[model samples]
Target: MPSSPNLYVYHRGEIIPLEKAFLHISDLAVQRGYGIFDFFKIINGIPLFLDDYLARFYESARLMHLPVLLTPDELKKVLYRLMAQNQIPQSGIKMVLTGGYSEDGYTPAAPNLLITQQPITLLTAAQVQQGIQVITYSYIRDLAEAKTINYSTGIRLQPHMRAQGAQDILYHQNGIITECPRSNLFIVTHDNQVITPKKDVLKGITRKNVLEVAHQKYATVEGVVTLTDLAQAKEAFTTSTTKQILPVVQVDDQVIGNGKPGTVTLDLWQDLLSLEKQQALVRV
Candidate 1:
């Protein structure tokens, strides 16, 4: 659905119309780009894995030294209220904690909490089946473990990615692959081990769940992965809140395995879907 005028958003302790939610020009988030955000999906009116998301949100705030104004229970109540007010069956919620407006525009002030929702863009089955192509670049995010409002590099490289006919950018440092611009990268070795980066990457919620399920049946390892490893891998995939588990068929000029989604990748994808279904039921 298109963005509606009637949608509601929660700002601090007050729920207001989405259009009415505003931040000052001198806000640290605007002036200095100091902020943190967490995003989760709402399915069938239930926020999925919301508690986990909230825990990460608070952790990010703590790492950034930004004080969270509300406790988890209080945030949950406000989120549910905003969800009810928006009345969307399937949507995505984003909670932002900003370094609030400061008189000097440089010092940290009280944090401003803002929560908003919009209709979620569901992935098409064909997109999953056909998989996606990615190109690699050598870079790493600063404060990699924290979910900060710093996507300048990723945003700046969008046009280059588009020109290369790739859907996403996989970031590596020196030759060791760290992550994609927006998701965690994983590869299945020919020996059947599921490997992902062990450091300097955002531990995505979906990646956490995928690792939990994958370790039950496959040998899962978190360590340094190199481009040579990807070249020798049987299959590769990515995990994220929005992307779920998507197969990575081609990376730059190298075609992964048979250039199609591998059996292990598909199995993990199914497992993630099953987990989501179970979480949805519990939320209901």
Candidate 2:
């Protein structure tokens, strides 16, 4: 397991040492795995796209019927203060809303909010250039739209993914491709159209921004993308807050677009980097 920094974490209503931030085993989150979380990057001391992330965080909490005691402004202040206290220039911030300790260990109660920061693991240049391979799994998550604290299925399949020499698993239901376990999937058609699944997937902030960039130049479509679509795609990629835009060279045994990053995928990746730089400049 990756070690957390010896910094302060926002727990309950106070900033506490990371080592001291703990919840009881009777907590609903520990007993029932009931919680929602939102994670975003802190780049050079700036919480990148924090508002969007918070919006989604609150939405997830609301959908799960978990109460978020802090308002957006209050949470922002806490995050900035925690960032200042930690003094980590580039890191990942995760805000969690857990179902508090319940009397019966089954019902929801007052939620506990926890915020922590950790070192960011960036993809190497070669990993971005060569792209990655992902194996397909015929499964769909319950409450697929919410960023819940349940990754049991994905975590359990780690060995299978590793044995297949794949970095991640792309999930589909029946024959329709939904998304990767941790990222959103996109494919470019031979006709130059960009397509991603419209429903049954978490609407990623990075995926939304990528669509914005793609709309500025290419035809973008959101609907069901199937195995046949992947096989016929001229290029493919996945997007997330941490991964940004990563090319998908191969899915299972079929090679995507000559087994390399496609021209469209490269263009979007560059555009995403440009967008990030622009956001960073605005932060400055």
Model 2: per-residue Cα lDDT over 1-284, one tens digit each:
34565788999899988988888887899999999999999776787777889999999998899989988998998998999899988899999999998989999888999999897977776789989999999999788889999988889999999999999899988879999888999999999999999989988999999999999999999988998899889999999999998999999999998998889998998898888777866663
> Model 1, stretches more than 4 Å misplaced?
1-3
TM-score, one value per model: 0.97, 0.97
Write down the lDDT that model 2 would get: 0.90
Off by over 4 Å in 2: 1-5
- TM-score for candidate 2: 0.97
Per-model lDDT: 0.91, 0.90
